[model samples]
Target: METLFRICFFMAMMRFSAAEELKRNLNGVVGGNVTFPDPVLELGFLLGGRGTIALVNDRKLQIVEEIYTNKLNWNRNSGLFTITDLQKNDSGVYKVDSKKARVFYISYNLTVYDGAPTPAVETLTVSSDSCWLLCSVDKATSLLWYKDQEVQNQNSSASSLPITVHKEDRDSSYRCVAANPAENKTLHVNVRTACGFNETESGDNPKQRAYWSVIPAAIALIIGALVVWRVKRRLSEKRQTEDYAEVQINNENPQDGTFATSAESSDHFDSTVYSKLKLPEVTSAEPDLQATPT
Candidate 1:
């Protein structure tokens, strides 16, 4: 009776141990590495098993279906199994058994998926004193907002979420996380001061610098053109005044008339006029006196 009771106790203990399953949930990206850590202690005596037959002191790991032959590797000492270049077909339940008990010991639930899309963040001003940060992604199940790597909002389940930015957060970096069952993606942006948008590290804008530089040059060119025009005008007026003064000086001299002729021609014309007018007056007077005497 005592032997039968001992047998029943052993079976019950085995059933209890088998009912306690060690479940591990893990995620793996496509074309990446994933490792299933052994839950058994290093010093624990665990014999490898195959079906109902137990291999005595068998330390070699026995994969159930041999589904992954080329990509799987195992460490006997640590009882760790690693798979490289993970594919979608690798997603499923992986079981490790204890050889001494011929029962499953550890089970790993792995999920493999393609990478998630990176989120895009933008800033908008709702009012003069209020601002909103918008985060967006394609096919995202949820959205999270972060300030300086610290989580600000985590309850968002939409692809897009809007967060209000405060005055104190202007100098802090804002981040957005877009997540799904496959993976998580993040993007960040630096916020500016309360008065304006974020400036470059040098505290200057290239376009503004270019505009300022061009302004001075344009003003200088305009001033130079004005100075050149004034100089030309002054020179022209001075030349006109000099010509007028020369004309006035010439007019002040009495010998500088327009119709004045040469001296020799005037004297010859006066002598001819006097000879014609004197005629034979003297000869006539002498003849009258001689007839009276006869």
Candidate 2:
């Protein structure tokens, strides 16, 4: 009967010890630091399952693992343990055990991840009234779109998400966030600039609208002036060629019967001139011949 009582007492003590242990979830980033909230009072810090990494006994700190030689630190006053330059493989269950067993045991499930990349915002389409935007990130755990400070949309398992913004809200702020459990990155955006619109929110003002229109108007005038100048130059050259041909035709001697000019050439000139010559009469030719015979 005494042996049965001893077994019952031992089982009760084991149940009490197991009930005192608590667990928590924590996250960390690669190359970054994390502090375990468990305050150390002569405690042993172990990694994974029963692998001692650090210990604080008799007010002296001892680092047992070679990997955590300089990376782990213990604060006596604050009684906190910190690890720096975390790696992805460092993610696991971390246990802190009290030497005297007076304090409850606490274990942390630490998850370490690489740094999150900043999301890129793309303008898909824009009209006079609204703009369509898309946000993209690589290997992100989640993507979020924010208008000002409020989240407008989010996707947990997708690499990209889309949002529609109205032109009336063009003056408001916008951003995209790519995040994992351990890290997050944000990218700010200006809707007006992203949508390729140069007009301001006060674009309805007549003076301001005209101010923006002046540049394009000036460019159009310059292009028109150049076209007109080129056309006039071509017409002037044609007129000069026609005038030269007329001068050459007028210089020819018409009496030589060498008017080798074509009809096409004469039609080019305004008018043409002609010269006529008459022979003297020879009525008394026969009388001269009779006198010579006598």
Candidate 3:
């Protein structure tokens, strides 16, 4: 099944053109004149916003793009063409009309892969000549390339994974990618620190030393203040306790030589003393005698 699909895949790859009035949808996409309900076919085109592909007069046209490196112009023997990065510019209709195969041929539909890969140089160390770089792509593809960011020393391979690069190529930021001949797909590899290239540490040594010294000094001052506060509190508490005790002692202790004595007096004031006097003693007797005479 896969073989038949591949066989039909390379047969035709139509391009966008104004001469052919291709169907906007997939009804006109898979094109072959073969009459086969069982013949498998696989056709791949770069996917994008431009889904429109045509097969009339054969002058393929797409919006001009920078990294588009491959031209899978549909022809008689170009069985299958892989449009690497299905780009936004590739969106439109795709139509194929080939008379090579017979008995019901089913062509595949559009699959777009228009994302960029991340590629980078990992290490530029080991004498600058033996440095090795590691690149990773965001979008995976079978076609990989090692590109020097500067000087344009580029190498290609069939790998969508990490590709090892040399050190002399390290001068430029290098990246890994998965690309197709059509150059419709594009991705860059991620990059990081390189070996052998020494970057200066951020701060000055003297400045770092100064900062460290001040931290210890500040810590010492804080500790000293805390100790002094504790000692002063202890001393103040002791003094207060001593003063309170002294006041209590002073209040209980006998002072100077003063004495307070109570006197028992014989001379007393009586309220009935005047009535019991000798002159008043005869009054009662006189009143009684006058009453008897009356």
RMSD of each: 11.5, 11.6, 22.6
The top-ranked prediction according to TM-score is: 2
lDDT of 1 at 287: 50
TM-score of each: 0.55, 0.62, 0.27
lDDT of 2 by residue, 169-245 (tens): 87788998898888889999898788755554555556677777898999999999999999999998977765643
Judge candidate 3 at residue 61 and give its lDDT.
34
Q: Can you write out model 3's per-residue Cα lDDT over 199-274, one digit (the tens) per residue?
A: 2222334556677789999999999999999999999896665443111122222353223332232233232222
lDDT of 1: 0.62
TM-score of 3: 0.27
Off by over 4 Å in 3: 1-133, 136-148, 151-154, 160-174, 184-221, 224-228, 247-294
CA lDDT of each prediction against the hidden true structure: 0.62, 0.78, 0.39
lDDT of 1 by residue, 1-294 (tens): 999999999998887676546677888989888876753323222222333111113455433345455666666666566777888887777654443444446766889987776788776664444578788777646788888868888644676787887654567887788876657888766656432443332244566677778999999999999999999999989666544311122233344333222222232233422211111323334355445554
Ranking by TM-score: 2, 1, 3
**What is the Å distance of residue 268 in model 3 from its true position?**
48
Residue 43 miss distance in model 2 (angstroms):
4.9
Pairs that collide, model 2: none
